[model samples]
Target: MNAIPVDDDSLTWGVPSRRVAAFFIDSFLIMIVTLGFAFVFAFIHLMSFGLLRGPAHLVLLVGLIYLAGWMASPAMATPGQMAVGLSVRRADDLGRATLVQAIAFTGLLYLTLVAGVIWLGVALVTTRRRAIHDMLSGLVIVRAGALEPRPW
Candidate 1:
């Protein structure tokens, strides 16, 4: 699909608070799903505690992949983002982000424990309001339906 020029003036960048809320929402959903998988695994193999360890990790990994794929899809947002009225798109031209971009964004987010503080500080100070992952992936999270067509 062709990238369309977005009217910068009309674009409303998602606030940090809203973005944080979305993160928590997504995290909670992922946790519930992982726990369900763990419970099922434990039930299926009552004697094999090792089943929980391996399957739990695999479930989390699959959840992460699902999250990335959801973000990269044409919706350009996850369920959390959708609920919060946020969508992620390429910063260059407000185009939908590719799967690679979505995966990188998710991976960098997991690194927040190590580099998040620094990145958060940078995001707050930047005019574009992009977090580290967003900056690294050339993505922007904006208010859903906020993008407008630019005048020729």
Candidate 2:
């Protein structure tokens, strides 16, 4: 099999293991935020004497979308990606991904529940180490600063 490049000059794709670690970190962070929102909602529900079911799920969904967009913005990377020394970029220009790509990437991730096994298999075998969501959004996850010459 051909080797994947990791030199300072070439596009240094993030290692699969690191990517998985990043995923877990991001998930945990998201969960924490969701839980916080749930707590607030729960309090509100109690105040209402259980008349309201609460919008924890909706808040979580919106929070996730906001988080993804913020992370993929030109100026920043997600906290988890930063922790893992990784970042997301546009596949074509190696620049920071746009908000649209960020949203689409996050939305596509939900599909993984139904087709995630296949998606994970593809990610494992792909040359660039990108998952289905990455491909669909024309984005790539790479070592942080791997494409530093270009504007973020």
Candidate 3:
């Protein structure tokens, strides 16, 4: 993978706004996935005399896991983040984030959602535009393609 320009000021420019957009996009995608699963599960639920309702709820968990995997993939961003030209990186070295970090970020992100989205407002005031989960996970969201690979 190419090295990211961690030192460039432009790396974080407009991140807060882009992140907001990405949030909506990702949410919609997740909703679609959930609905699709729900539809199939509902049919099975009927066939199985309502015994499938419990497993149907697992769709949410699967969606969360998928989101984390996407974030930790080589692309370094979720589908929504990629759509908005944003990427996640390690806060300490701007290196690609590990799967562990991505899972942590995803879990905390849902926690923030449950606690009220006001937590996201932190990005507006933070120097790096990081949300609470981003900070806790030691990751930063930046404008993708803002930094070119350093010829090392």
Q: Please name the candidate that would achieve the greatest TM-score relative to the true structure.
A: 3
- Regions of candidate 1 where Cα sits further than 4 Å from its true position: 1-10, 47-53, 116-118, 148-152
Model 3: per-residue Cα lDDT at residue 64: 74
lDDT digits (tens) for residues 8-54 of candidate 3: 66789899999989989988988888888889999999999987678
Write down the lDDT that model 1 would get. Answer: 0.76
Predicted candidate 1 versus true structure: per-residue lDDT over 3-110, tens digit per residue? 344546335454576788887898888888788878877776676755545554566585668678888999898888888988888888888999899999888877
lDDT by residue (tens digit), candidate 2, 92-127 = 766678888888888787677466556766777776
For candidate 2, list the clashing residue pairs, or say none.
none
The local distance difference test score of each candidate is 0.76, 0.71, 0.87
Q: Rank by lDDT, descending? A: 3, 1, 2
Counting clashing residue pairs in each candidate, in order, gives 0, 0, 0
For every candidate in turn, the CA RMSD to the true structure comes to: 3.5, 5.6, 2.6
**Best of the two (1, 3) by TM-score:** 3
The alpha-carbon deviation from the true structure for residue 141 of candidate 1, after best TM-score superposition, in angstroms, is 0.6
Best by lDDT: 3
In candidate 3, what residue range of length 10 has the lowest lDDT sum?
1-10
